[model samples]
Target chain A: MVGGGQLARMTHEAGIPLGIRFKLLSDTPQDSAAQVVNDVVVGDYRDLDTLREFARGCDVITFDHEHVPTEHLRALEADGIPVRPGPDALVHAHDKGVMRARLDAIGVPCPRHRIVSDPADAVAFAAEAGGFPVILKTVRGGYDGKGVWVVRSEDEAAEPFRAGVPVLAEEKVDFVRELAANVVRSPSGQAVSYPVVESQQVNGVCDTVIAPAPNLPEELAGQAQELALRIAEELGVVGHLAVELFETADGRILVNELAMRPHNSGHWTQDGAMTSQFANHVRAVLDLPLGDPRPRVKWTVMANVLGGDYPDMYQGYLHCMARDPQLKIHMYGKDVKPGRKVGHVNTYGDDLDDVRERARHAADYLRGTITE
Target chain B: MVGGGQLARMTHEAGIPLGIRFKLLSDTPQDSAAQVVNDVVVGDYRDLDTLREFARGCDVITFDHEHVPTEHLRALEADGIPVRPGPDALVHAHDKGVMRARLDAIGVPCPRHRIVSDPADAVAFAAEAGGFPVILKTVRGGYDGKGVWVVRSEDEAAEPFRAGVPVLAEEKVDFVRELAANVVRSPSGQAVSYPVVESQQVNGVCDTVIAPAPNLPEELAGQAQELALRIAEELGVVGHLAVELFETADGRILVNELAMRPHNSGHWTQDGAMTSQFANHVRAVLDLPLGDPRPRVKWTVMANVLGGDYPDMYQGYLHCMARDPQLKIHMYGKDVKPGRKVGHVNTYGDDLDDVRERARHAADYLRGTITE
Candidate 1:
């Protein structure tokens, strides 16, 4: 239990009844989960002494963030403290360049990409791979809609290199939809996969996720789940592993990225699945038996609330709640900021379109885009 | 949400999303729910000025306990604060004598009893009712096996008169099982009922609750649900209402007691039912549309953990958890105490007996009574 964000908060919430104690390493005084769990030590995750002290009495160490220093985790492992999704596997989530190389070596299908240390390399890759509208991403530490760039031309791609950050130039993928398939794996190599979800991104930030990826062929869903499970088993990752996939115009799925902890797309499991991703993550990290990963409902949709400039953004919830009381919303106890991941709402029902629309309406209402 | 006990704490857990905030009123710094919900004001619920301060900016005022003063609630009502299950209805729960009289007047099937102001009346009632064994209860306040006594002989029946506490006496009927039916009602008079559950009580404290009350005839379950709904409507309770019933040897259902808040018997709804009792309580208190009260599984069982003097109580959970990983346990984050309503474990499955056994084992392990 480190980092007191919504993910840590939700994980702590799920762990309480299991009689599993988690000592959260909170970054702020008002971390959402800390309000209920008192064993929080306020500190920075980057501080080695703080990390060491937090891990002292714990039997194992895990994380809420992928930004943990790999060398520090390796050091903790050397001191006999078990770190799940060990340092060897975490680097894939921390560094984009390392991930691309590893996935490419493993023959995982991905868009054409090239590591560009200099502006000239990006220019050359663009000319050979594709022209303009290339995707540029930081080699290390990027999340939500940050640390990624959409370069319309070669000149735009060259500007980031001047700032001394490693970047990758990816071919503009002609994808029909963004999909995410998540799998949880135990240290013993057992794994379970959830249904693939269609992820709708607004301004590079995920806004909505529909499980079973509406209209996706059953074969494709099977293929996507298999791909995610293969990656989890191959990486020997202990914890939830999310594989973001791109459904190309040709209906082929390509790897987009990976997350080792519980991902946003799987939040629907809180109300829709037999076992939630957060609960499974805890089980995986603790080396316990995995739970059934089947969806409990026919369809589930999750919509995220991108924080906007509204003081009483939640006040609008009264109307949404009054209109459709079945909608489930999870708000992180974090201050609102433009384009930040504030909270999410999930709805599960027999009608996918209706669930999706209702979820989106609540998100749009929360973001202050609706009059009623 | 003034009190930081298990009910308030569980409600806070459900209120995380949709951002419903709770201002916990605690008498001690370590009140369990207070530890997680940061917005707590330390005060007694008896103080009107303190309650006014607590209710200043709240949209709706609700409760976890029915012990708040009726006069203070009436004052708040006159001042225009929206208190769900207003003083009039809540008073019925706080005073057992009033509840009994009201139910008797309504023609609801209940045990023939008399409100005894002292032990002499109880002795007299026992003589009239033709019983050596009689049950005596406090009229104004009692809960969880407290404020009630069994007078097996004439001398014992007359002993409580010296204490000057008002008592209620009832014939000790031979009953097969205790059952509880939970119903939720909104301000608009719409009400919903959950499946009746057979409660297992040890020493007057409820230890386990088996949902659908195994082998209950279809007509009996329907009759219980209808009786509970009728009670809720007649009482005009604008939130959760729990009717405790005794299934006499002849199969007749007799009302035993009532609760105005989310009752412990309904905890199974959190995981087993389509709409959780907590979520429904929120909807009812907020005057929102009620959700569908359908059970997802055929059976669900909840077992309470009585914090006994067991060394390394949590250590026992490891073994129980290892055996049944999916059993859901909700802990109250309280210090250990004998006969205390510390927490509960719930398990739901199609196989009723298996779920019951699993729940029973987890609770027994916590109570230091589980055999290998």
Candidate 2:
């Protein structure tokens, strides 16, 4: 695995039961996954020499993020290393413009969008689509609300261009709720799609996710899964692929974004589904038959625990654990910093409201946002 | 932790989510837990200097096994190091004579037993209890099927005495099956008891465990839980405690043995219970509130994956995972060796028979005991 963030931390954990010896190329020894994984190389993933050395003796090289340079991945593949979710598919996640163009070409439903060279082009594109209040995003190096902006005027649209990166403008989605369809694929063409989930975002960061997208019509849910599976098959993705979507009030779903690695929206699967996204990713990359994606319980809610002023979340565990004994808390081994995702909590049960409340409360308490 | 084995490996995993910093005193870098835990001291656990240095920064010292010398534990306790399941309680697990005597004093039922100075003494005790076919066990350092014998005569009984350890003899009860009651206790007096489970032993090693003990009368199950809880309270145990019991054909339960750490019989709890035994043990030792011990499903079966001729168990994961997508497999990072406990698999569902077969099949496949 390349990159030693929380996703890798969790993937390392999921691989333990499968007897997978993970060899991580981390930027530092303090990276979340590096703290646990036994075999780790602290080096730059972008360096060809570092990547070559790290891939040695590794069965298949998968990723924890899509930030590795496309040329470097192709280089590894040229050296006979199996880079899962090969560069061809990974490029889509690396650049929003490419993803939108590819999805548009495939007739995948997406908001009216166009790559813009300058502020005037963005304005013209927005005018052709709808009007003001358009979404402007940098085509690369964006995550967790960064490199994204809501532009209501030409002046606001010019902000993203200052970074000297390719920008794209799309008509702002008028959605009732955000949904995600997550799936895993293998090189052998095996694929499994998880239930569509409703994701609640706070300040553009994923806050909580409700599996099966509560109250969603069965046909629409099926359509979402089908779309995700088709995308995985069409793109030849050989690992987890999360399709973030927007469900408009008009009863239509539009593709929002894509992540080639485990995404926050599917965190609920760690406790809710028969097989977790992390575990399935390991299986898929190894070309092992994928496990079931069915939900184990009727409802499941996962809430992210952002780092808070309380440096020691362990102290809050006494209250949270006693209050909700069924809550499954997962923490990334990281220092607390305001607004950083440090952990998450999963709650599942027969009742959606009860499960949601338990998950939310535990996350809040751990983040020190709630005292009671 | 005082030892670096599979229990420690699992306990270390459970502690990760709680933000617990585990400092392990492992005998070698190759020990199961040592392979994962970052803060490890490779030293002899019996050496006072080594133990003292290991416990310096640790908030509380706990164990993966009860074999730590009683004097070493006392020395640490005297130095103001908090040793959970203190020597007073751990001594019971360390010596069979002490445990049997203490249980007898507290009115806990047990088979006819006596501490024998030599082979003649063992013979006289067996004659007084019933006849031939008595169980002889060493007072300390015994695990699995080691240090135990089925003595039919004086000659056979002399085997254990050669080790120069204290020997105890007991009438071998003709039991219909074996059961285990596992519980966790916090220093604050909070405790939770898991469902009584039926454990099947092959060559005195735990082969499989069925949670809730299929076909067990509710009354007997309740009695077993109550007895386990009482034992924890009476012993002042501040961590996981497993009460091994024999359910005789006459419809009575007799205490067989006690383990102060997580036992093989409770392995099913990793996936079946609301909170796993390893997690609860960590919480109990940390003096945190205990989590719920309720089963997540109606039934769960855990089957140990004993090492077989196959060296690479990972090759078999593809079949086992695809065949039973819901099976939860846990592997200890250990080399394959005949009859060694390499891992275990957990299967839980509403149907006991279905769950049992799935667990057994996965375990057997991983062990290479069964193919196709």
Give me the candidate number with maximum DockQ. Answer: 2
- Highest lDDT model number: 2
Worst 10 residues of 1 chain B by lDDT: B157-166
| TM, every model | 0.89, 0.98
Per-model lDDT: 0.83, 0.91
Per-residue lDDT of B9-57 in model 2, one digit per residue for the tens? Answer: 8888777777666788999988888887767789998899999998998
Stretches of candidate 2 exceeding 4 Å from the true structure:
none
Write out the backbone clash pairs for model 2.
none
Candidate 1, residue B62: Cα displacement in angstroms equals 3.6
The sequence of per-residue lDDT tens digits that candidate 1 reaches over residues B87-113 is: 889989988888988998899998879
Native-referenced DockQ of model 2: 0.64
The TM-scores that each candidate's chain B achieves against the reference are 0.96, 0.99
Clashes of each: 3, 0
